[model samples]
Target: MDWSTTIATQVAQIPRSGIRAFFDLVTGRSDIISLGVGEPDFVTPWNIREAAIYSLERGHTTYTSNYGLESLRRKIVTYVENFFGVSYNPLNEVLVTVGVSEAIDLALRALLNPGDEVLYHEPCYVSYAPSVSMAYGVAVPIATKKSDLFALDPAALEAAITPRTKVLMLNFPTNPTGAVAPVETLEAIARLCIKHDLVVLSDEIYSELRYDDVRHTSIASLPGMRERTLLLHGFSKAFAMTGFRLGYACGPEPLVSAMMKVHQYSMLCAPITSQEAAIEALENGTPAMLEMRESYRMRRNYLVKRLNDMGLDCHLPGGAFYVFPDVSRFSLSSKEFAERLLMEAKVAAVPGDAFGASGEGFLRCCYATAFELIREACDAMERFVDKLQKEAR
Candidate 1:
């Protein structure tokens, strides 16, 4: 008769995101310049928006097939093949999900047996560990140090694996930490997984956001890894289409088929309008994407420089739109530091501990904010750090 027990104990065990709690606090507080959210500040490209508009005008309002429209899946196949070198069978190897988040859930739910061990690198996207837990999987987080440039440690990763280990979850150009796995690193992981019979779930939503001369490598593209890797990517981060609720997965056919059984029960399919828009996005968004990525690189460079110059030890953001900086010198807990940054500093950033325990004593500042806002926020942080130092003295 108790409402609390009726709620799953697993759900209670999972902590609400530390990032979101403060995000709610800062909402509608115009006095603060927010760098708390990882979402891009860019609008979805006009052509992609128009594609959705056209789809709706043409009466594509109902849901598509449970596996999704074949046409869109084919486009995704071509996109992945051309860009990431991951070949997928459009007919049976791709499943459309609401977003990369949902695609991640599908992979875990479909593949994970109870108590299966799932490994992911940290500081990672906030959702990965909890998502595994929901599927009755054990989340084994392997922390990557700032010294390693937040790269996944193959030795540590291999050492963490046990007989119970079933899934290796990967997020590249990662949320909050912006670490990209180079090709050579991914091949080593591929060899490790091949030796271990581990299933790979790669969250590659930020694949298009690489900066400088760095190329984003997909673990799935490596020779042996493709068969075992369930690739999760979407239009959200790359095309600034987070609100569209569109994503896709490509993997071995049997797994994709297994996912649709769950998918059919879970979401059926994404909106037809959104699918049509995403098709166009996958097909045509590249040119604009390069421009947008260049803009993000510029922002990343500026934000990293500003933070370090202000005495916060920010690492270079290789990709994505986040900069995780050490705030340990302030002697404030990450959440308290974030709160102080928002209050006295009149600026906002997410506490690094929000992502994982490995993230303490740091904060994840999203460089997705506008250049103008970034410049002003940097100026504000300078004064804020100056005051904090003076107080300590």
Candidate 2:
């Protein structure tokens, strides 16, 4: 039996996630100080965990509506309206998902026809391109630069637009780079979406992790964007609920309904227990979220300063837990640099090009690890870099 023809071409073409191999390499190594994965080091807040337990205790274990629990959906409405100034009707405009991952997949599947184009900035989360491909849509990369703090260039976006362009996927408080799109940039992109008649899929999962008094502005909140934007968010980053696998998509009725159709058959509904827990996260988890955000801010400050002081060019990340530092001076590809750092220093960081080609000369260090571990990783990295410089000499 020839299995080559058995596998789908798209599945075969998709490269394995670069983040996963490093994670596997360090899985049981106690000596490795990892700043690789974006997972939050914090435990889920007691209140949120308790809510899930309470739901189980009350025997609320049956399948929820395919759209998720109505109560949870209503809370999601209130939560988004309060935090993002966006109004969503719980009944027809919100769909609970397993994670923002699933929400994104559902949106692409629901929206894109064959050969349609999906535009997203490069050095983005690893999933965007593959997800677009799986949906049979073209993944268009818009390169953003470090000099501009990785903010999306509206001119670049405008030039990328074509008749076949169907969606604009955005992740801010972006992964890998930790760039946040400013209100003006988002507004400009929003206007272009209007001009092109493109649907927007704004993944704001890290919106709660902004630093130095920088507030996250959701593109969906901009005027006229609400109807055209599918906003994806989850509890993983902000509420330390990564294990719970709860997330949602909210947008206009038609888009939400379309996504829900795909979600219903594919996912049915998000876990009932996780949905109940998410309600608690939105309702009573604000203080805990803020506290965690502050911790990340402090770590971000320390890591950026230490990396720059060591002669690595690192910019202050405006949001998200990752910092992308340029490593071109080392005269190695990002993958080679990461491998050498892991082998020589036992300090694990992700190779930036894992996110996209535009990420070739950088590395992503996640600060979501413990502060002491982060400091240790920084120290190890500095020594490793010093050794490399000496060798070059």
Top candidate on lDDT is 2
Candidate 1's residue-wise lDDT over 297-359, tens digit each? 888898888888889998897888899999999878998888888888899888889899999
- The residue-by-residue lDDT of candidate 2 on 104-187, one tens digit each, is 999999998999999999899999999999999999999999999999999999999999999999999899899998889999
Model 1 per-residue lDDT at 60: 80
TM-score of each: 0.98, 0.99
With a 3 Å backbone cut-off (N, CA, C), the pairs that clash in candidate 2 are none
Give candidates' CA RMSD values in order: 1.0, 0.8
Judging by TM-score against the true structure, name the best candidate: 2
lDDT of each: 0.90, 0.93
Shift of residue 353 alpha carbon in model 2, Å = 0.4
* Candidate 1 structure lDDT: 0.90
